[model samples]
Target: MKKLKFTIEDKKIAELLGRQNFSTRESAIFELLKNCYDSGSKTCDIYIESNCIKIIDSGDGMNQDDIESNWMHVGKSNKGYKNEQNNRVLAGSKGVGRFALARLGNSAKVISKKEKEIAVIWETDWLTSGVKETSVDFSKGTIIEISDLRDIWRWKNVETLITFISRAYKGGDMKIHVHFEGETYNIYPIFEGIKMGENYVSKITMRYDSGKMRLSVTIESDEFRSEVKEIIKPISERYYEDVFDMINEIKKDEVEEPEQYLKELGDFSAELYFYLGRIGIGKEKFMYKHNEINKLDTGVILYRNAFSISSLDGKKDWLDIASRARLSPAAATHRTGNWRVRQNQLFGFVMIDKNKNPMLKDLANRQGLEEDEYYQLFKNIIGFGLSRFERYRQSIIKKIDDKNKIKNKQKENNKNLKHFLNKPTTVTKMSEKELVSLVDEIKDIQREAKEQSQAREESTKQHKYDVRILNVLATQGLRASAIAHELHNKRNSLESGYKNIIEALEEYGFWEELNSDEFTRVAYKNVPQTLERLEEINIKLIAFLDVILNKIEKNKFSQKIKSIKNSLEKIVETWSQQYTWLNFKLNIKNDKIGEFRITNDVLEVIFDNLILNSIQHNELKDKLIIKISVEINGNTINVEYGDNGIGLSKKYVKEPKRILEVHETSRDDGHGLGMWIVNNTLHMYEGEVVEIDGNQGFNMNFNLKG
Candidate 1:
């Protein structure tokens, strides 16, 4: 048999390695930069002109012999001696990285020189022909002049390119300068706008190596200090709780198998900066650009050997962060207000390289990570940290919001009290008792405010201790005042009950008559139909006392229980007795988590308002139906409250969440503070209530631990 060699067509070979390898024009440009860095270049300048793109690098330039051996060789890279590398790792290893020229342009000319040798030139009309080499004028380095442009680099494109360079290349010794039409940009302005946050919520750094993953997290949102923030202390203290509480908080995860993190995968590190409030605070122009960049190029980029992977430059969430954000849209990035640490709120990068993370391979297209086990493990480990950060972020945001709501509610309460005290009306003038009640309420608010100030100075995490009390008391004050004002007609039956008992006794004497026998006679066999009426009045009196205790009493902050079944079932029993005509049903599902970490008082506030709102707004046909379903999974407690009276009101039908706001109500007799209290109190428990749409009734679901 004769030895045969397969002929490879130059055009057919270029077709697969040129534009086909790079997915974006930015990626192509980045590949060329990687070449300069890999060549041990300390300084590189890029000039963008009207006709051509020129890149000049002060690196180990190619000689004529070197060009013929390596530069001309397809499917091969120039590595050996250059990568001895003076402590710098080579970024371009795929050999085909040079075809980036063909991806950006149809023709190119290269001039290179090495010490003590004549400078050489290489020319090619890449689309139509092959390469040619000769002598040239360049000395000590290389200059690549590319023409026949494919994609024009616009202002935004340059800005994006600079961002990638700033993030990826951290070698302080190397210098990169970009020259546009007339403007020159270094690395400063590309990211200075992102540092405008007053005080960042956190800057988390995580590293994986030696079969272990360690995270160094710094939290700095002092503005959110006075809220009930979830810290690592409590979690670390819980014996039954997860050591990795943040990762455990994930409700929906697509990754099923537990990949051994940092086992086969080599060493890598990630740094994430979370900006909660204002980004680019004062620089309006820069803020506009930063926000625009955040829409795409503003996420976690991947860097290999200090050079960025252009396709993974956060324009696409290779981290699957946006997917998690989509799972909880309420707290994700918003167009206007109330944005928490969603996907876009975080800016960061993950560093890896071919020598260390050889298994985490980029596809032949140089776009995505190969869909393999290594990629899955890489994402999973990083995602665990992300999920943990989300919980921490969500905790901080909820507490901040709860604190603000408390302050606003307190201010409104004080304002209303002052209005009533300064401008006394007919009711206050007529009833000294009502005036006294108003004075007591003002004193109570002042006392609670003082307690809050003291509690805040003691410990920010313990602020929830006061939050529980204040939420219950504030809602009670608002709702009680409104109901008391409107209960004039409802008092007639109570007055009649007292009048009947008094009449039966007053017919004789004050001291001689009003005894237990007289009470019993009114309770059992009074004149005609007084017995049934008296029994009903007695039950109403008892129910009234229970209401006073639940809403007006000081919150037992120490009463945090693991099982919500005891507390919730008790609530159902109490409500059944309190509203004798209403049918209250409680269903418990997935009691695996025991119950929840929710306080007893906060639980009452959530369910009470849901049930009360049903009675206040809708007419009862036979008996109002109140159904509560509680399910536990992991550490989260989910509860759905539904009533069979009516669907959502027309005013809040479109946006059912509107009913949870501070002064939103449908009933004339409603306090409007009921649902607001329900919403805010839940936030204190790391919980949130979302209104769900249904056909037959009003339904809302909430989580005790989110």
Candidate 2:
């Protein structure tokens, strides 16, 4: 090759890169900061005055030769071949960073000096007289001063600019200081003071033939810590048009596995930090300035190659957290499900190494990554990680709610007990003997009345609980019957298919051909195998139908006297299988308590309602623990049932009897029928139910006449 030269209009090219490359003034500033960072700058200072803007940095300054060859060139940089400088990876490579100055103002002055070198000054009018060089007094540093501001800079804009600078340059040893008038603010210290309430971290590394992609998510708060890891599948074609469609195109052209399509995209890693607001601490502990944290633009920030991506900065619903919350209100609210975390409650960075993710390139406009297969896959992976965190957070919130409820109940119970035990009395108007006797009588009467009141209250609550159970059982029964009917229909179809197969074989002269040894061997071998599989299916269907029928029949209330233990055990066994996440513990202190006049239906309704309430209302991540203990005292059998779940609210706890009121339920979806059924069933049996204090979950003590 003899020679190759490229020519372009300098003014036009600078304007294109300056105006088209950046979407916002903040991004333009970020580009300038990135240049300083790449120059091995340890400290960068920004000063915004009435006349001009200045960015000064203590970095490895460039000499006249380096400036003439590299700095003056557009679209070509020495950074492409040698990626690292000053023990740090270069953040800029396009040789367009100087356009940031043009984007900011019309005129610019740059003074730079390298160690043991004479200082040089470069002056430029972006529109004409491109650049002129001269001598300066600077020593071993770089200072950029620009005049003629392009846009109005309000106080809010300056605040946002400072925040952007703080978030963009967090890693490494560099320090950024901003000055407005006489006030000076440091970026690092403000960033370090962000207070969080809860945290969850997840790291997943997916391996392929070529390389591996690593994803790290950190959700931090002042109180909790959790982590999870799992492999996620790529998005379906119906969801996004990029990744799946591209893969399908590849398959149409070549014979290859679906996995091969993903393997070609290469590998990369991303780290996301989620800040879930303050916990049990005051606002004074926060590192972020008050105005900065309260800004409307606060959201999850995205970065590529150690610099913030301008398009994704201040984007509210990048992950669609708010829309998801709106769709599922129960999951997003504080008390209901607590499964959603909004965009405002989060701030983090996602870093993708350029060398690894070759396919994941930036768009020409610099708004976001290219809408390619790799980018779609990356979004799906991140969405999966966030979903996992939500589930974990929901469980934690449930536990906290349960603990607080129990604590508050205990405090109330203690206060009431103290009042009852320490009632004041006057003995001035009566003899000592009469006073003592009268006081004893009054105490006995008050105690008896209190016991009766509590018993009535518990009986009402038990009824409400019972009604809910019956409703759940009825719903489940209908579902089971529907399934059984479907199975019955399938069984009939299988029988018909069997008959058709046999008839077809016979009609096709298979029986006549069976006389031949070869035909006979094949028919005997294959026919039995097919028939055996059909028989096995028929057996399973019959067994399943029988189980369903047994449960339905047992639900019919009877006047028979059954062993309480046996009835409870059956109900427990059925519910245990249905809710495998729950732990059922049964303790029978007296084995010879004999039989009681209670039907299986009553027991099923009671047990099912309690178990259902625990499962539905519980917010804890741990398995629900339900304890059942029975003891024979005198002529009555005492039964205690309790669970470690979020108990009833204070209103319901104080007035336990109201729980039995028709249509009264703590849940938004409740029909308010379960507890009503329980109350009526117990009344019919002449049994008594009382709510017991000192137990963590919903505790009930009932006595059945033996």
Candidate 3:
């Protein structure tokens, strides 16, 4: 075989490694800053003049040997390739980044001096620059002067460079100052901006040492007292079970101690700050800081040896946080699309060392980390921390929300009760600010609802009402504000209550909810409260419809006495079949079904309410059995109904008929309306329904007008 050596071309190689390494002009400059960081520089001062750029740093300067062996040598770097020195991990390892000077300018000069030696001057066309000894007075740091710029530099480019570099190094001991147009600006710590940045509502600290990961979050109580809560997940618990098992299968015998596989990731400490809130994100503070935060690129960032790593800035979702949140969202289900603790809501940094995490190396292009097995483990671990923080955040929020909901609901129920009872309510005079503040809070809750839900439409309407209230308060003072509160109550009653019931019943619409005097937008699926809400709204709507029906279309049989042969049986069968799991069985002990001059629909309200009450109140029973006894009096029909349930609610146990009043029962919706509807309809027909309490299950006795 003939011996042959390949020809080497320096200029083409320089172009390939230099200009081809970065995607933008700003990143080319960033590469130079990384050189300063690798050189142990504490402060890098950059100057941008008309067509020239100068970068000077304060650190231990390099000698002729370093310039020849490392800086001048192509494809040879020891910075991140080896171990850490003097408590610093190299921000860069490949020797190719220095050639980036060629990408920025045509000519570049380097001046460097050791603490005890004279200055060394070197110049290059980015391939092979000449070096000479100099007697010029110089400090112990490297200085680079680049001129003959290839592209026009604008102030916008300066701003972009500033933001790019600032996003890299989270405010640290190392400082960067840029001088442009005779103005010098010190880069500020990004996450700790003016208000929202400094005042994060929640913070989570995570550390991995040995083989275990430790996480703690600062939780604030309603009293504003803050305490750290330790989160302990078993080290054996795999965040990526399939990936781990697959890798384990690949390793087979080599992975004798499979549980210790996470140790390959080495150790790291991370601090995550939730900025949108706990720096106590209230409605007022959120509104004040929202615009400022929205303008910044915010996400979890990674740092190596206290220096920001390139390509891991906030602009990139390297951890896949936003997508993960958008996919699952967990407890943030009420808020659509994204989780409350997702990427944009957080400012975070993970500190890893190149020496400890040798495998977590940057890719050949220097754009990002190599997505290897260890890197996947690292990302999975970070995802675990985020999910835990999200859970903790949701738990705290729900606690506070439940407490507030109770208080707000109590006040509202009292107000609604007074309105229904025709009693005077104590309305206090309010200042414009207080009234506006109150309206803002209500709007805030509406805004808190998910956009895809009907709650959002309610939110929009409420917002318009809030704006009108504010406008009226601005003009009319306390008088207008006071009148607004009264209007709010009246509007809710008439619009939400009567209006909703009239539209819902299809066989009539949703006839069940008409019992209550107040209404709310319905839910997505069937719940225990659905039937209760339907009937309250239904009773009134049905009764009102009955009155209207009598006026327009007359039924000759509607006024005549009719025998109630199978009226109660059909209602029982429909409901019993509807809730098959309840295993309802109805027995009629009386031979004669009641006869009445009433319509079958009117008889339905009495038996239907009685049956609905049994189903609502019975939770512990395996099955419900209803026993009925019918009696035909001289001019009226009487019936006794009883069910095997948990019996009536405690308050209604004594005077169960009182449960027939609106908002009287334990059901979350206006359940009393259902019974109240039955009561009123029975009364007009010359029959009344009463409750039998202190009995097993529920018992009610009522009669029909004959």
Candidate 4:
């Protein structure tokens, strides 16, 4: 035999040949899969036993010369020029995938046969077992059985793995069978809406501040139909592109304030994309995108190599990664390999070298890509894709309009047909209440749609009755709380109030004694009185509702002040009961004070949080004097709420942010959300929350706008 030089050292060869350092064993497996993919395998079988991970592919089997020369070559090309399949250019071409088998297993065995009488057998231990190269003849296809698995990252739920893989590959024509812990999970494909036309794929729609744009793109597809959906699919594709373009164009437009549009677009589109895609992506055909995808029910999955990497970003605008809005390649893709990689961060990227080697970097640390260039590129590409879609959408709309004009004769027929097709059968007829509820739901849906479309006609959507209340308060300069109190007092005096309504029903011959005219008069007059009573009840109900809903609008100042008063009262009462050793009293400056137009919930939370802090944490034993006072000056409401308790640490006083953030509430003690809410609310109103300096006791000074 000719002398073999073997210039590469054995130790160096092992280090270079063994693919390791993957975060998970699943990733290592994906690397093995890429090896089979490069070998021109249409389908590869993965079998997982208790102690082994076996992979068998129908790709071309390698002979002894090929195995030793190419397979064992650490960084040699597996498929340099020929990697495309089904007109789709394969992403992995790196030779590093050969070492993936070793990364996932302690020992790997290969049984491959070319057109020869005998099959070839090659064995090698990943750790310290010298490369044992032998050649026997197998029947035909390559069979790779890797055993003695060390770090196989097996998923407890194979479904998770399948979902991950499906997203990674865009649900390509490949199949993934994950055999894990007694069950096998098969991953299917994910395609843009099947009902939606193929044109909708890779479209970008955006909503900025008050501007709305629909963008999409259309790739040529074989399937064509005259159905509305067929037309819609293409239109949607164009719309996706159109919307993205519109957002980009906003910056280029000569608007009076283009920056506003840019800022708003950046903020809003995150939600718009997530929700739109979520809703439009259907579950049954999760293969297709639909509206439900944005619902937060079926979370977004980032996938690589047919495995989920992280939770999908929700319907929220992200200023970061906005440039990636239109570039389809940058979006995550699926894998068919035994090894894959997954990432879950605001912005993440994985670079695969020409040799199929993967390297990852997260954009969160502000590494990789310049900021200005990043934004500009994002704007340009997304705009480009969107504008194309918009044009297509316009064309489709024109066609639909022209078709409608010619089909006037079949209008009724078409209406009937649409009704039959779109309407669903109900198990039971809806009651009037149910019908009314449905109407409310439909109205809400319409409102949400309008919001998504950037409908700016803010022509008061509140109830006329609600409007009257707002007008009365604004014009009369009467506080809502006082008005509520007045109404309650008035209702108490009237016989037709709650007390009288019950009395009337219990009265002697209440129904029969009244004539039709008298009964009608009572009913008519009672309407407003009834409404007034209801309003009184609503005042309380709305207050509670506001807390639950985080209602920022509607009687915010009064509600906030009231909540603070309530908290102070509770603190006083609690101290009186629990601490017999101490006495705490709240000194109120006035009956009605601090009319700051701030979020009621926030104000309440702030006061409650602060007061509770004083009671538990502050070293106040007896005669604790708490002052709840307010002063209004120059479009601002200055509040001085303090306690004669041990003041906060001096260090924390100087660095308020530190104290606000670091302070954790004991179970017995309330968390600092009260102070936080106060600080946050003050900040929202262009105000500040600071610990008053030169104070012996703990004093929180808050400035709020009226």
Cα TM-score per model? 0.53, 0.50, 0.52, 0.36
lDDT of 2: 0.59
Clashes of 1: 0
What is the lDDT, from 0 to 100, of the residue 107 in candidate 2? 80
**Model 4: residue 254 alpha-carbon error in angstroms:** 21
Evaluated with lDDT, which candidate comes out highest? 1
Question: lDDT per residue, candidate 3, 86-188, as tens digits?
Answer: 4655667777888778778888998998889877888987555688877655668988888998778889989888877777765365688999999998986
What lDDT tens digits, residue by residue, belong to model 1 across residues 182-300? 88877532233454233243556666662443333333332222213243223221111112322221222333433343455777878666654343322221111122222223577
Q: Write the per-residue lDDT of candidate 4 for residues 1-706, one digit (tens) a residue.
A: 8878657654455455554334345555655655555556666667777678777776666777777787777556555434464432343444455666766666788887766535677787753433343554444567777887765444653444455444444434455566667776665544333322322222233332223333333333212233545535545322222123333333332233444434333322221122223223122211233323212122233333232233322222223233333221111110100000111111211112222212221121111223343244334434344333333333444345345445543533333223334764531465666556556656655654654343222123212322443365355434544454555455434424555554575585453434435544776555444655775665554443333333234565455444445645754564455445445555544334445344444555556566666767655475666677755564676678777776665334533343343122222234334444455456557677655542467777777664
Quote the positional error of residue 412 for candidate 2 in Å.
7.0
Judged by lDDT relative to the true structure, which candidate is superior, 2 or 4?
2
In model 4, the worst 10-residue window by lDDT is: 333-342
TM-score of model 2 vs. true structure: 0.50
lDDT of 4 at 597: 43
